[model samples]
Target: MLKAAGMLGAEMSTTRVLLALLLTSAGLRRSSQEEIAEQQDSSLITSLLETYSAVQMPNNGSMPLRVSILISVSNVMDVDILQYTISSVLMLNQSWYDYRLRWNETQYPHHSITVPLETVWTPSFSIREAHTVETKDLSPKVKLHSSGWVQHILGLRVDSNCNFELFRYPEDDTDCQLTFSSLLDTELAFEVSYVNEIENVKHEYLVTTLDARTSHGPGPPSFSLTLHLQHTPSKTVLSLIVPSFAVLIADVFGFMLPILGNERISYKVTLLLGYLVFHSSLVNGLPGSSSCNPLLIHLFLSILTLLFISMIETIFVTRIASEDLPSWMSRILWTHYTPGNQNTGDDGKRIEAEEDRVTEPRSAQEMEQRRQKLAAGLDRGFTIVYVSFLLLFYAGFAGTWFLMECHTEARPRPRPGF
Candidate 1:
């Protein structure tokens, strides 16, 4: 029984030793595999770099390199109406194939590798209308796939020039474009794709449409991003048009006061002063452009002139009713009231007496009645003329506004593509 127990103990010890040996062998194999992978990765990287040249173009000079670009607009920073410029943030994803950077999948454990952007050849792009452009990389490194594809991402803050159409002003809509072109002399084919990922950007102008288009010419291949912006006229209408109309209505009703009193003249003068203030504010608030000025400016000026003319007419009528005119002026005004020469005989005396009575120095009541009648006739005629002018002016303005609206609606929009 002692011999059998010793034998069982020895058997247990051998089994334990074998298990330890197996574990050691498995660990060694795993460590070797890891080392091998590391060596292979290093070798692949070394080989790729040794053969690569960043200054050289990706493909042979015989054919143009085809590059695909994706543009994503992140935000619209500002739209300057005075400067006619637009500032925005854009993310560009540019991808191309480089045979020099390719590696066989079986030879390397990594299906993709990250390399510094400076170590790879990239196309240089510039904007045609941009006055200022700042570029930043999404990552310092670019991704290189085993199949020879490369992707680079960058962000740009661009301040580009835009032509603004302000004929309708507060009711205006404008189209702005950012054109990007390659600076390299080597022939290149560009495929542009666009997506708007804008978020949390608010302004008086809202982006109504976004489009991308490509153009090929003798100079270079170009891509354009078009942004259609619509102005929100609510603010302008409330601030400008409403107040202008109110002032105009008040001026029109000023005629209700009797023209013979200082109250009417003073009231008209006050309205004129108030309108001048409004006009000054309007001119100062609006952006000025030599090419195109808003129709609202002209409308304001016309209203101002009408108000001044109304005030002048009021003053003239007041003078006519309140003050006596000179003899020569009265004779010119009432031609039939002139006195004839005195006669020497009875018949002449009778004629002279009749002339004196007809052209007599009238009493206060009679003279006042005649003056009031003349002033009332002049005032009535002016009121008719003023009302007619206002009607014609407003009708013309409405017609112009309607035609502009129709024209804008009928204009064809550009189609987006590669």
Candidate 2:
């Protein structure tokens, strides 16, 4: 019985040790699996990070592998024209960011990316003549840069379809400019054409023009260009011709007013002069360019001609009034309603000599009446001319405006490739 109990205790000890060993082996296997899984997870995370890491930029001419963190410029402010904040990275080499990046992302990542950016300022661009804008003045507002800078590159796009002119001085030799506050895209170029946008602010871009306020500047006075994305290049001949015709009509009537010596001559001259001055101011408001905006030339010519005609007519009328008329009537002339035989003094002829006249001053009265009648007719003719000219002018204006409205039609378009 003792031997049996001893053997049983030994067996129990062996079994207990075996059971402990089995549990230990299982635990070790689980640990090994957990370690492998951790390694794989680590590798996956590293790959992801590396794949989407910050962009790389060429330094001057050399390529350096550096960590760059991209930070989306959430809201671009006015102060950013000078400088703005960038992402903080432990790496010193990654601190420098390049501004020449093309930002293309619907939802930019808020996190900082690891990429270098470059800022570059390009030279001024040349603006040619023959550019036409809806208005003479360009808006002062401009957008130098846009937000959502994902990688190191920030695309600077400048589009111009309005304000095709720059007012250059005689001494200025440099061309007009379109500059950015930050940097510019030297690889890219500029394009401009006629577009019909009412707002000059819609085409906000990073191009700059000369500011003529400076003394002896490089180019003419520069105005900010407003792009009209919604407008297209299309205009009617009538739109180009109507304003000119209106000015011409007003000019023609200006001549007749003074010619008739009408009392309202001053009023007519004033009205016509006002139109001429207003149109002149309007033309001068536009930028100076070699291109012929037909309307402008037409307005200038018409106004000048009208003024000339007015002055000439005034002189002519004055001369006419100063001229001497026949002595049949001194100031006024009246008709002598008498039988033919009444004046038959000697020769039985229905004639009366000056000496044999009735001496009633009828001839003078008649002459005066005739002169009054002529003056009245002249006044009436002037009035008619004035009214006719006005009607024609307004008619042309209305027609031109209507045609412009009809000609200006908007059509949808695909996005332009930058």
Candidate 3:
């Protein structure tokens, strides 16, 4: 019986030892987990930046740093044709990798960390054609991932110079560029991306296409964002083209009035004056460029010239009808009344009488009738010529305006050095 009690006591001692070992191991594990959590919360950032140098380029200047650029255009604020500038609201996202900033997630317990931009190295860049740049962020920061990736986001209101092809004017589609170039001497390989979040509304221009490309030349790398913008021509058409067409139609129909009365001449003079007002407005509405001017300007000027010529023709025809025919014209009209064959005798007398009958009218009523017939014939001939000229002129203008490519080839501007 004593031997059995001894074996039970030995088994109980073994059970106590096993339970004590398990409790000790559980406590140790809890302590270790708490220590790790504390390190992550407090020391992770300090450890990362303890040896980091913000000014040094990654990879010790051996290889070109690869930077991924994403430009999200939220709104096109304004496109100034006269000043040759475009203003935009843009969100710029730039990302790169730095091996020095990397850390083991198992130890750090952080997927990513937000750090002040002054804490790490970042790519420096500038807009080549920027006239004004405004930053929206009061305090800028960067996001560093545990996997060595760094992301920087910026909000900007930029007014950049744009070379616009205004040959087609209101119906034109122009290409404008926003060129971003690296200011750092350290070489950079760029991967460019573009996102156009513009909504189609009543804006002056619609961004029809977006293209992103990189330039790797003798100098630093540059990334260009080309926006293909189509103009909204409704307002121009209503204001300029419609009014010009109406004036031209009115001038064409003005020939229907009687040329014998003063009404037609006065009417044409009034139309010409009104057209001058419209022409002045047209000139003011379209902004001119040194490279190429809008064809619409020339078209309006040509219309003005035609209107002036038509008025002059009306005055000349009216004067011809009001007065008697000149001697030279009467000779032409009456071939038999030649003065070269006349002698001082009955033949001369008869020739003089024939000249009187040809040059002068018999009665006031007959004279008026003759004037009316001559004026009507001349006016009819002019009407035919004027209408025919207008038809041909408009046809040629339409063909040239629609079919011909008039825009100047865009040349690359010199990249400004930082």
What lDDT would each prediction earn against the true structure? 0.81, 0.36, 0.83
Who is ahead in lDDT, 1 or 3? 3
Q: Taking the tens digit of each residue's C-alpha lDDT, what string does model 3 give over 196-302?
A: 99896889899998999999787778788888989999999888988888888888888888777698899989989999998998898787876688989988998
Using lDDT as the yardstick, the better of models 1 and 2 is: 1
Order candidates by lDDT, high to low.
3, 1, 2
Once superposed on the true structure, which residue ranges of model 3 sit more than 4 Å away at CA? 1-42, 323-346, 350-365, 409-418
lDDT of 1 at 337: 30
TM-score preference between candidates 1 and 2, better one? 1
Q: Which model, 2 or 3, shows the larger lDDT? A: 3
TM of each candidate vs. truth: 0.80, 0.35, 0.80
Off by over 4 Å in 2: 1-150, 153-226, 229-280, 287-360, 400-418
Scored by lDDT, the top model is: 3
Candidates arranged by TM-score, highest first: 3, 1, 2
Clashing pairs for model 3 are none
Clash pairs, candidate 1, are: none
RMSD of each: 7.6, 17.8, 10.4
lDDT computed for candidate 3: 0.83
